[model samples]
Target chain A: MIELRNNELIFQFPKVHTQAVCRIDFQRTLRIPDDNQEYPLPPGLGSFPINHVDDFTDNLPATWKEHGGVFIPMYQAEALWMNFSGHYPCAIKIAAGKINAVSGTQWTKKLSNRPQDYVVVPDQPWLDGFNVSKGCVRQFVAMPLGEGYTAEEQLTGDAEHGGIQIIVYPMKHDVYVKYMEQHRVFNIGDEQCLTYAPADEMGLGAGGVMRQEIYEDDYGIDSWDQTSGLRCFVHLTNSAIYQKITGHPPLHKPPTAQEYTDSGLPWFDYYADKKALQGSASLSQLTSVAAKKIQKGEGTLDNNENVHPNTIKTIKKGRVVRDGRF
Target chain B: MTFSSYIRQSREGLKAQDRRFSVRQVAQRIGVEPAYLSKIERGDVAPPSEGKIRALAEELNEDPDVLLAMAGKVSSDLLAIIRKRPKLFAELIRDLKSMPDHAILRIARDVRDGDW
Candidate 1:
């Protein structure tokens, strides 16, 4: 099932012993503190409502009902990533536009491969579609739904498909223990079942969000491999509910490439330094303007601007990190 | 080279050889939505499991071994062997591909002199 807490989307399948979570970033620049950055979900702009696909039977296709899972609405070109945590171990399949976005050579085959849907593992955090490692792909990106090449049109009919579908399969406990043995480890709990790659290595520190977390410990296993745990299995069934919730609007068609460019925001840039502007005079003034706008209820808080001017003033006066922005 | 592209090419290639099967017919035979099959053909998704690939191969009258290799998988019987000596297998395939079909057939037929 899917649950949203403090803007973090969590998927818990207790019967399967897996929990997948991602911070829902409606705006790309929302910074998370080091101690709190827990999952592999990347920071990005835009928030979509995630709900069971069964509830919106009238809005979905029979095939979608067959998959019977959760869906999230996304505008064209809007991108987001998911971070997974598991108590046991599970191989996750990310179906974007109803197509498996990760696994196999879809990540390598050029003719059908699009940058929109791909996986980013610890070895290669930022996806260039070139720096891929065979088994460790952890992060999954669902590019804005509704593009001509996406599976959206066919999966949800013409009205829907502006979202992504996710399904998780837990590794059989015996298989998990076997994998543990093969990897020179005797038990599962000692490894954290979690792999950490720092925010900098993940390309998070560049400009999108400044996270204090660093991924130092590395595990040599790929949790996304389907064949690792079980040779044969069944598709985990959804509990059967697919209702569209508030806070997400239906797709009014995604933005055109021209419009996105005119807006002057690249999807994400890993090398750009958005943190150094704290000392710039222009940025200082911009924050003041931003604060006034916030007071007027038309705040540009979500925009790429690094810090609100009032927060900066407090930081300087108090000589401490205010609002968690460095 | 990918299972996705391989399945599609095999599907199209077989259909051209014997114009009897439509994508929908094969999809129905495999018990998948036509769109889902189409996505598999287009490499949008990872190739489905070996069972689905085998079913597709049988329906298309294509060789399952070729499809399975492109799918980056092997039968369970071969998995442990491959896992144990991946480099040896990789080299064996690399060398085998360079051999002519006649030479491969000659080696297959002459077991006594084939170093078996």
Candidate 2:
């Protein structure tokens, strides 16, 4: 089952496991400039408020009613990152408009380690964008789908769906308990119909590449409770359509990279030397928002350039380090 | 989420699945006045006692421990056990807090399997 609390989507599968509840918050952040530069992670300006689409059935389109899950407003060029926290080890599968963020393949119900279509958490604290390379991901920039820039349209060449789709398969109770007894570590519902119009709406597109890592699963394939999982569709509504549907403008408009740089807030760099997963060979071909905008020449960027790379804060990995007597 | 929001959403979620799980019916079944339960749901009043929380948890099919933890209360039964050796239990918890979850689980297992 899925529950929206404090602007976070909480997913749990009671029959599968009791303690496994995952909370995902969509974080609004500065859109890193797509200047072919690898940048650090950006600060979360705020979380966009999420509401159930069922609550606004009267105003939403028929397609939205058919895909009943949740909705969040996003600006034209705004960037977003998914922040994940949960009680147990689980496999999180992410897709942008039905395009897998990890492997850039079509959405699948089963967990596949052949190409590693999902990321394991709490090793993966946040996902910024499409995992294009081993240690870098293109930032998730919100754009109106169907212009052929989003990872979805670029991969499938069709903008049938315009939102983020997430499926969480938590560890089985026995496996989690046994693993906890041995190791102390850490430690979801149904799907909906699959029909959507190609009408222009907010969808995530590949943007600037950032330094991040998607860790390989440690629990092995059989550990996940394949019998049941929770899947949620997070619809991304563009500003105007969102206003017409919700009867109010978006609560927060995330500052652009320029405004954020001027304010002197810190961008971050996380250091972890763990083995990383290989990125999708197909996902590497998608274009960033800025690069695509420059090619199309229809819209202008919101002064998202001129970044100061030296000002970024480097976060050392939190592993226990030995201090030899000196 | 806070105690109030968690209770409200869980109730609403169950109500969405089964309309029989209404506020008034639930409040009456849990042995509290509808208005008081409503106030608790709205955060106007503090959460009820452990008995009420356990009853509500059973009614909503939720883990009693989760609800009790959200309400910032320990289960009375567990409290009674702790009260038996308060100082020793307090020290045990203080040390357990710093250890990893597996270590604590190991301690619990050893104690449960120990000869009385």
Candidate 3:
């Protein structure tokens, strides 16, 4: 189970009520197209093997599409929530043995606070390393959505109120590594895995035709006004076994300055400040007055009344106004 | 030759033929610093040597002898054709001069057929 603490909003996952598991099955093997060699794996689950001998002509497209497979458990989603929030500062410590005997048991205790939202993998380090006397393990802690909303809400909130649907994919590892390298922090280890995040549309399966006309009809609704549905995926590994066998970090790179900058950290700060101001404004009588105007087909104006003529024209044309006036 | 003599000859040659090439345009075609080309044009620096003249010819898609004449060197027949219809000839000449010449011939044929 992962423990997430974000100011007043603390949530834990794979809660006692949920039996969520994070499993990496190494027995699932696919033929390496390059040499027609079969390899037991979990490392290349989301990517094509870079060193394979065959020309990537045949395998690249399939590997690119299934870059990351989809299987959602409640705990993974909760961890993603923490990642998106940009609030919970995270630190992970994995032990070679069982989680109960780990040095960071105190941190694990906090996982009980919001148990329903998390899943704690007690022996993740050992399990990840089971293959080579050392298995790969990774730990990631991120502040997901600063506003404390779920991934679904962040994604579909726009669609709920005649807004655009923004599909978000997980981040990729190469990009994460590049960011880490840019920030000059190449050695911080396994707590660094990147997941893909899609920007606008979700993928459809075979025989599922997406209705492009529906989007065409509602195309003007501002997608930027909606919140982003971003989830971070953490790859847990066994450090001792991984280092002895492969001479590399189980994780890619820890946080770097570039990663912090590229991760929209500055934008989050601005968003947080803007939200605080908006919250303060909502508490005033002005909001009630505005609501009344909205109810009566009257449009609200901003602080600066130097409105554009085009805006005025649009407002007049909208249902909120009548007779070329608001 | 001296820088001043070279610049004077270049300017006289261009003016003698009533050519309309801008220094900026020449610099852009030849991939040289505009400021450096400007200095040479203004007689502040020498006109480029023969090798540099050939390079400029290659860049501007003109005959090497015409470029040498432009730099106040020997004149050539190609220079006369270029001077007649600078824009059209420049386009035609660039197409003729590019490596793997058949591609340009095909495009020219396409243009003639109004398929471009």
The weakest ten consecutive residues by lDDT in model 2 chain A span: A190-199
lDDT tens digits, residue span B12-94, model 3: 56645554445655566666787887776576776777766776656444577755765677453556656866898778777
lDDT of 2 by residue, A199-235 (tens): 2466788988898888888778777877775555668
Q: What is the C-alpha lDDT of each candidate?
A: 0.35, 0.75, 0.25
Cα lDDT for residue A163, model 3?
7
| Rank ordering of all candidates by TM-score, starting from the highest | 2, 1, 3
Error of 2 at A138 (Å): 0.3
Candidate 1 TM-score restricted to chain A: 0.37
Q: Show how many residue pairs clash in every candidate, following the order shown.
A: 12, 8, 42
C-alpha root-mean-square deviation, each candidate: 22.6, 16.6, 28.1
Model 1, residue A311: distance off in Å is 17
Q: Alpha-carbon error at B63 in model 1, in Å?
A: 64
lDDT string, candidate 3, A117-157, tens digits: 11111111111110111111111111112221212122323
Off by over 4 Å in 3: A1-113, A116-200, A203-326, B1-116
By lDDT rank, best first, the candidates go 2, 1, 3
Candidate 2: where is the Cα deviation over 4 Å? A185-200, A316-326, B1-116
DockQ by candidate, in order? 0.01, 0.02, 0.01
Using TM-score as the yardstick, the better of models 2 and 3 is 2
Q: Against the hidden true structure, what lDDT does model 2 obtain? A: 0.75
Q: Give me the overall lDDT of model 3.
A: 0.25
Deviating ranges (above 4 Å) for candidate 1: A1-47, A59-63, A98-167, A171-326, B1-116
